[model samples]
Target: MKKQLFISIAAFGILLSTGCTKLNETVLDESSAGGLTDKQAAESMIVPVYATLPNLFTHTNYFALNEISTDEAILPYRGGTDWGDNGIYIAMHTHNYTSTDPNLRNTWNLIFQGISRSLTAITTLPGINDASAKTFLAEARAMRAYYSMLTLDMFGLIFVKEDPTALSEIKRGSEAYDYILNEFLAAEPDLSSDVTHGRMSKQAVWGLLARLYLNAAVYKNLYAGQFTFAGEDMDKVIEYCDKVINSGRYELSPEYFAIFNDNNDTNKEIVFAVDQRADLNGHNRMAYFSLSGDQFPLPEFVGANGTDGPAITPDYYRTWENAYAPEDPKVDPRFYKENLSIYSNANDTCVPAANFYINRGILRGQQYGLIRRNGVFLKCANGNMLVGKLFHDTRNRPTLPVDFTEKVDFSVEGSNYPSGYRVEKYEFSRKSASGRNFGEANIVIVRLADIYLMRAEAKLRKSGDAAGALADVNLVRASRTARTPAPPALSNMDLDLLFRERGFELYWEMLRRSDMIRFGKYEGTWTEKTDANPQKRIFPIPQTAIDAASNLPGYLVQNPGY
Candidate 1:
């Protein structure tokens, strides 16, 4: 049963660097998974597999691949031995990572270990025979394929074995892609066509396959060359989108905030999410990292408790000037929240007070020491959600004193704030620090919004209908802008505009590196600009793994040019 809690247990390791084996150990053994009974062992096993979802690429996953690759976020801690060890490599991609730290073993272990878990379930889950067991098996298979796809996407290789104890048998580059795809194709018939939102079903698998194929050209090229999507591949992408759209099982959620809020898991638009339970199993700092109390609004919202991790480069912020968009200030409410929203739904109206924080700077980025009203600034400030929360147990700030336990409202823009924006993606602890079940929020893995955008990209590129693609892009973007009286729209249809729209819509959602690679932007220079090395797009295989397998001559050739 514990093994089945993969996705759910992420909360415990939100900031975990390594050694999470026992933390996520599968408790459900032979009988717990409805074992050999032929009853529903398969179904029971599936639960544990899905439980690993949110944990897959969250803290370790995002930093290893997503944050390093994307524009809006970056790894902040330096000289640490925890996660994201490829700090120098990260800066090479973005040209900003400056540490000469040891090679990143966190991502290497997390992904590999996580995949190993998926393999364990995939190999063992089929033995069950109950309805839930069957559903779980299908979902686990789909999930296993999903993890395999990412392994291929990021590193170009994967350990193809499912037996947890099996010796490593590396599948290289494109061959790995082929292996993962085969699993997906095999899974198609097994998965449920039902729409279970956060849980995997047939439709979710379809969307993931579509995603892999949509980027087939890149996968086939092994992150080395530019490859075009074959017509058949394009057809495959559209085919999957058709199933999801036609199935009527899922739809886009109407409100922007609701999509990521505490209540979002129930939203109609969610196809798959990393489920988070307040007291149950959860992902810890991901949702909370990007925010701060100074920027968070209202009573409990006044002063953020943690160090805000990263900020938008003024230059990156300006990339919003996609000629196709409307006036900047008039953009959608999502822009406000996504780009900048300071308040949590703490008081509904009164806003949160300053004191009820998890302890500012534990996740602190820039703690403000001064606040004064300026004629130039607005009396009431708003937060930008685009540059979402970034705090993570700051070594700089201390914990709270005894008296200021609840809400203490005051105003001071976080100096670390992006153009004075705050994030509300993760909920502030209901009780600043009660020691357990404090803040629980889902980490969305694949969602309808992402699929819609992916489809938009494929449609625009495949069909060469810029306006039509813009429509799809804007379809998702429009929902994010309701708070603004005059919302932004694609002003001119172009690649640059499309990229900006993607940024506006999907900032810090953990797709930066891949998006940059797909658009040929990963190698380009930006603020804190680093000249991109083509070899750096995909990280070098962790040295530890290489050391563990000394027999293979070419196993550690290094990613082309170390």
Candidate 2:
């Protein structure tokens, strides 16, 4: 029998009682309603908390806020038509978004849903009075802290709710930072050290702590003109990073692309990720979001298509291009992975192949894929597949070739079907043949490379140990030995170079915005964005959230510069 954990409507009422708008109240999974053992009930309670992650991290919501708003990506109005979405993408890219923006509202709601669900588990799990239930409670608290940290990063405030009925006490500045840090520290003892896949574990806690400490200055003074990286905080960051590094539970993946592949759930490098396996509700938007509509990756499902979403900005592309000078960034194992092995020539009439995989990493120039005639895929006389050059799929100019150009303009003509280079870091899901939604690739939130980078940054910032920092950065750079002509290590490292190295290693993973702010480049002009206002560092609280809490006179105040 399928295990079903049915959370009652009253439990949902508790979430809604807080007056937060758009709280997802649906049941987690559909299973035959029946009595469950205490062990089963505890497990069921924690499942919904984990389920909230997929929705929170979806490309349109959290991803848009983090990537599109920074120089790493741009989502312009394609050919003056599609993806306009009431100009939210443009507003986000330009930092002109207001409190009423749907993306902000949606992201805010989704995060709170995670917080609320975790809170529900934290409050109810103790009733079981079992050893497993205690562990589940610890996991719930840790998840709540994670959601709270995200809230602090985005909205400049953290919500603290003891129970469901009363309003949440808001914390900001040091209070917020301390609360999040303490929550994790408190839960660490009870969190299982064993790898639990999607669930919170000890190593995940350590990674999260390292991340929190690495950015301690930013959290401590969010709107300050300049942040002061305290030595003590840096020490803590190093301490936590060392814990994960020496744990022997993880090692860097030689093939960098395999870290984000479809079967990456068991990958040792992934410390924490939003689990999106075959049986769960995983979306392939991360894989197909930036792809051209004309490109079809899956041979089995011709209907599976890309939505032509945001692409890597020229400003970000230059970081890789100019990094090694003369030597093309393509040589770097992390930069690109060639997967279309059967067909090398774009003009090939037919190639014998049972499987087809598209090239990964930063894609440029003309794209090649299986061609279709009328409603059927074209095949050779020998029953092999035909590969051909791709053009725009009628949504844009059909005659225009799908050649990605680096120089993207803000104008309609400049933002054509193929302007900025598209990223294919995450592997396309084979399970979702009909559409680009059900992806099995677990969206990585924390990994070993990031841990190493965090430690390096802390080492440099805390003590100006340039040599020590360089060694750590090169460790990550040299770990990708799977690719031919492995990425060369840097002879020297500085703050600017270290920042660029982070981009080269971790771009499109949704860490760019925070990175830019912490590195003092958030105010720097890039491409079309020129506003250098400090207030733009944190997003305005959603107007809907403010309106929902209107009953409480000063409970939910909006962030400045709305």
Candidate 3:
């Protein structure tokens, strides 16, 4: 487990500013350096790759396209006034977004930035003549492959470069897919098997390979519904998943929430993650991103208030209700609910009387928490902390109950501030009031539970082995070595059951987009989304990208139905 202090990703950005150019940029300084050591140059070369990861899921990037675009989550226009960013969020959910959508372009640019950095490393790192340089080069290729996979998955096109000076050729469909596969396979032997959560290690490579192979059919066929998970691809998925599982390196965390805590960097279950910390470029948004304005978690920490951002769709929440008797989330280990909880910033038990902490995970029903009255926490006459209905706005005059009711009005004018269930999948950092921005929790990318689920899906899809698939699912359920009070074991499994199970296990982790596409559910109706156009399955090439490519003649083109 590499600690946050080990690398200065900020310095990498500074160096990258000097390195970001066409492959034609002269690799002058390092190639004939008389000052910097070979290892120092190699270190400098690899930092930009890490630099690209933290922002991938931040705010309106890939996470928006993955979760908000699906039935899992939504970012409606709050109060019919805020969050109305030209109706882009609604358009994203409705499948009506155009090439000019800001989030789409931001996601595209961020991913390409990663590709460009990885290409720089791949082309520049080999100038050194040390054994470690080989490892660096392999990691560069692996990082490039990962970025390319995202581009290929999101848009049907990828930029292929032969050498530094050569113009990039845009490859699409199976050709680009095969190129990505080759990159991963080529990097495998040279990658270290060490548990570097932030870096591209052997286990991360295996996990990436499994993910790519699992989605191979969708990548191959693009929008076609006849995407057959080839026997060979399914075998590769199983093979790679086994590599990660059998490595004796990771396991399911005993406390499900432990995997998302501030100390998650030490969790063995995380195979690959984005390292976030107070000292590094960590974002605290995940912890407070979903909570409503009235449900404050850290009243002691100054400026600790919910931004009232995205929330889970009622449809996705119904998955839990449908699974459990009486629909009580407190009975499930996966759902973290806190009621009658008191919180103060900085552990000052005298926490000024006005604040209270809301429990994490999905919040529903009549919400209960503390409120600020005259800069002091309020209390009941009986000496217990005061609890009341969560209000909507900052003024607390509108009197909005925190009861997350179904049947949200999807229209801009009809969208309410407290319409959906808020999620705290990533543990809220109690370390600071402004913890949302300075969060230290490592954002999990790949983990042991996901590996088990992948293997189960592959087994079920490839050989019709329902018993084998059920056993794998049961392993994840029963092996709550880290989480106590395990959820009930699932039996009598089928395809639909497995699909719902995956939702319960991996929701809000950026897996919903590909999973829905693979399950042929991407186009299904839910909430405000009704468009099922197959072309929308793959995002359109941002118009800016197409226009930029036009300068090179036939180098770039848009995906179908853009």
Candidate 4:
């Protein structure tokens, strides 16, 4: 894993900085001095690949990919919210957004790195003689399928160079979908069915295929306008979903929060995740990115140095609570967790909760009646910590067992201050991490919860079998929550209901954008945003991509609305 990590990053740096002209025809770099003969050495390279998967799901990235893509969600317009203007640009192009930025290039590069590393493995893994070599390469191909799905989903193209020999002739555009599809189908047999969470298995491959075909209409279209799912594709979607279900390796975790509560990496629902391994002696993690205290957390989760980033919007929370069918009692338990601070910055005080929380607010606000021993609560007039969960980020850490709560405060005063809610889904770990770096986190990419929802969509579309879809959807809903009036009915019976259910179930998980697009809602209206154009469905091919292939003339024209 370590070798995989080093090679993936090193190769990525080389690919990003060097254009195609200076670099070899192919973008893979296997020159890593790491010996691949032994399992120990071979696994190092795999580590980087897995390690980097989490990078694409960070606040900075997910915001661009998820929330910004949906009208059901929005950026706070706060002074520092990133507001994800890049996604807004596409949203605006769709007529749902008006903001803009050039830095979305960063997102472009990060995903591309995933692509490059997968390519490197696909091209190089076959040369090894180890008994497990084929298994590893199959994993590599699965990664390629994963990223290629992203590329096809986002850019409508593939790099098309699995083999070093096919390097020079590689092309991009909607034309690349065929190759991407073939790659995934080819690799499915090699994946295992052992039911590993966050590890690509045969079931996961099926999920990818399900997702791809579900959106086949959009990918294969000549002009993207109100794209609709085709019958054949929808059938395939159902086929694959059933394959995943019949495998019997995974089932929805009874508790949504438990899936990510701590050590969620083992959850049966998780098909893939970022292995946030922290270096105890080196850099403190999960704490650095999500922690608030500057005194502990490797002394990095404080002051201007910390990310102190994005929070759940009040509007989004409302959607979760209101989107349910009222007749069904079980909704997502995570919904209640949506906008609260699950970790104390450093002072150990509970984080705040409110429509727009800033800091040190209440754990449950006035909504649930839960609170701290001090009778601390949300101030409605001030919107301070009125709707939140204040736990301790430093409750665990390997380095010093240091109390991150002692070093900071979790309260806020104004502006975009949580809008009264902090996302507790990725809580600060009590122990820093594997190596005590405080950077460790349990990643939840394709959890069982997600598969349930994906299958619901497929089944619903396949036969207007919202009854079947409703069952699957409600299964997830029933697992996570308890509610007043017996919760809501599983309305997978209605397309609109099913669509909204997805947004409510998958909020902030990086799947929202694609889900919205699949449901034909990407260009829909949000609280304060809207997509204006059709071409914006897919992102503008990064400007750098054009320059790299500019010599080929018409080789890489940008997607419209650039």
Per-residue CA lDDT of model 1 for 1-562, tens digit only, reads 4344433234323323221111122323322422233342343344445555545545434543566445565333321322233445345335433212233455566566556556656665554345555555666667777777766776677776656676667776568778878888887786666544656677777888888887787887855656576777877887887777778877665556566665555777777666665533454555445543223322322343433334444445556534325665324554443322233332222112242222221121233221212211122244311222222223322332111111111112212122223334455444333312234455566677777777777776787767767777767766554455434565557666677666765666677677778878877765445666776667666666667667877655555545
**Which candidate gets the maximum TM-score versus the true structure?**
2
| Tens-digit lDDT string for candidate 4 (53-82) | 555655555445555455533333332342
Spell out the clash pairs found in candidate 2: none
A best-first ranking of the candidates according to their TM-score comes to: 2, 3, 1, 4
Q: Whole-model lDDT for model 2 versus the true structure?
A: 0.83
Q: What are the models' TM-scores?
A: 0.74, 0.94, 0.88, 0.72
lDDT of 2 by residue, 1-562 (tens): 1221245423443332221111122223334123656665666567667767887888999999999999999998887777989999989999998999999999999899899889878878877645678888998999999999999998999999887887789999999999999999999999888844577889999999999988889998988888999999999999999999999999999999999898898898999988777656566478889998888877776777777788888889998888867988888989998877534554555655556778899999888787755656777778887777788854645678989899775786668888889998888888754546777888889999999999999999999999999999999988999877778878998999999999999999999999999999988888789999989999999999999999989888888887
Candidate 3 Cα outliers beyond 4 Å, as residue runs: 1-35, 339-357, 373-389, 393-398, 411-414, 431-433, 481-484
Candidate 2 accuracy as TM-score? 0.94
Judge candidate 4 at residue 40 and give its lDDT: 33
> Whose lDDT is higher: candidate 2's or candidate 4's?
2
Write down the lDDT of every candidate, Cα atoms only.
0.52, 0.83, 0.75, 0.52
Residue lDDT tens for model 3, 1-562: 0222123333354644432211111222323333445665666677677667777767678888878888988888887667789989888888888899989999999898888878877877766665677887998899899999989888877888958578888788799999999999999899988736767789999998999999998898886867788989999999999999899999787777778877788888899888775545466477777776666565454355577678788788788887896857557777764524332232222333334445667766556565656555465665545555566547354566656655454764336776777787776666643655656688888999999899999998999888988988887877654445677788767778888989987878888988989988998998778897888898888999889877777667777797
- Return the top candidate by lDDT: 2
Question: In model 4, which regions exceed 4 Å deviation?
Answer: 1-41, 77-103, 163-174, 277-308, 311-315, 324-332, 337-422, 433-439, 481-488
Q: Report the lDDT of model 4 for residue 75.
A: 34
Specify the poorest-scoring 10-residue window by lDDT in model 2: 17-26
